[model samples]
Target: MYIPAHFAAGPDVIRDLLTRPSAANLVTMTSQGLLATFLPLIYDPSAGEHGALQGHLARTNSQWSEPAIGESLVIVQGADAYISPSWYASKAEHGRVVPTWNYSTAHVYGKLAVHEDPAWLGNHVRQLTNLNEADSERPWSVDDAPERYVSGQLRAIVGIELVITRIEAKAKLSQNRPDKDIDGVVAGLDAQGHSEIAADVARARLGS
Candidate 1:
């Protein structure tokens, strides 16, 4: 989350990441220690100033039962690739370039609210399903299953709502590097079948 000015991502970028298919690491500090869960969240931009996140945890999970310690953090990560030192013009010129990782990430801090209502859980699950299935030609829906089965599934989980207090997003896509080095990185990533990361690096360069 220590972002330099060049790599800082704004509101639009954070919102886009949250709404995508990225899985978030939900972290909370308990009296015993720190706990984390990996889950896909439903982002609602209109719900708050920074937007709200919705997800669920298994009923047996101890995370929900623990008292809210401080602010909870949800980390959403995007495409990332290893940048080789050879992918820099400076490497050949002065042999001063070093390897680094190029990636995009967002840290969302919020207040956690847990809910056990079956109706709320069902609705949240439906929304999450629709968001992820939208791109599929034949999208499956929660209602596609039998009513009894769906209700039983809902009972096995607890719904979570995180009211976003703030967000810090970063896109370390070689923004600090010169245009020549960045171009080389893009080329290398693309050649290695990391088109997503390559595209992100290109986009970052263009935005700069």
Candidate 2:
């Protein structure tokens, strides 16, 4: 993560990246080489000094079973978009503008803890489901399914927790641009149906 001074992420941005309804790429280095799994994770604030990310992998997924040689990594990302030079106000004034990208991401590093316990898996699934379904009108629950079926399903997966040691995060949301150029970017992104990253840029501007 090459974080420029102006593109650094703050505490709130990092918190949102962890807590939002999103997935992460969990990477580990093993004798079999580097293995990665895309997984949905929930931040558990009480787990360690810096908290932990909790998720699960299928029992058949070798990434969970492989012995990690050292610290594991989780790549969490937020809204990202392509920024057109036409959106920059300075483009007209100097014609020196080039297209760029706007994004927010975090590289989370921690120790991996694996759990095969049924009780742990059950609770984790419930938490993850609720978190993702929070915005849904008819959110489903673990109890909605048959008890035996739920237990059977849990048996097929293994829970994983990343006990956080450190994190390197970046948020490059046009923060380096001038105010008028940033304003143009917001309007352009909105017209292009990228309101999510537009909102991120707007918010980052305010914070800056």
Candidate 3:
């Protein structure tokens, strides 16, 4: 995460982005080599102020085949859009603009803890389900399902808990550009039908 000063996000911003992103790419290293797994993470704020993350991967997946409690990297990516040179005023004035990516990303470095307790793992899975579907109008809960079936299903997965030590977040939304240039970028993105990137640019500008 090579975040320039202009693109650095505050702690709250970082936490919000991570929570909203939900899914993350968790990377771990073992004696064999590096392993990466795409997982949906559940944010737990019950640990006082700073929170922790909980998730799981398939037991058959090599990513969780071995437990490495040392250092791990979890990458959470937000909506990203390509920025064309045509979006910049400088492209017309001096032809100095180049294509760039405007996006938000967060990298969390932490120690990994693997849970083996069946009770804990069951609760962990249920909690994750609740968190992920909390916003839906008619949400399904773990208790709604058959206990024996749910327990058996949970047995096929490996539970993970990350004791996060550091978080680096960056929103590369053209903060380095001047106000007019940024406005031009936003307008161009809006015109080109990239409303997602335009919204991100607007949020970045407001935060700045």
TM-score: which candidate is best?
2
For model 3, the superposed segments whose C-alpha errors exceed 4 Å read 48-50, 191-193
Which clashing pairs does model 2 show?
none
Q: Write the per-residue lDDT of candidate 1 for residues 1-208, one digit (tens) a residue.
A: 7999989986666766888876789999989689899988988878778779999999999998886799999988988889999989988899987889988898889999999998889888998999889999999999999999998999899988889998889988898999999889999999999999898888888883
Candidate 2 global CA lDDT score: 0.95
- Candidate 3: how large is its RMSD? 2.2
Candidate 3 TM-score over all chains jointly: 0.88
CA deviation > 4 Å runs, candidate 2: none
TM-score of each: 0.95, 0.98, 0.88
Per-residue lDDT value at 18 in model 2: 92
lDDT by residue for model 3 over 17-59, one digit each (tens)?
7677378899998876888988898877674245677898888
| Best candidate (score: lDDT) | 2
Give the clashing pairs for model 3: none
TM-score rank order: 2, 1, 3
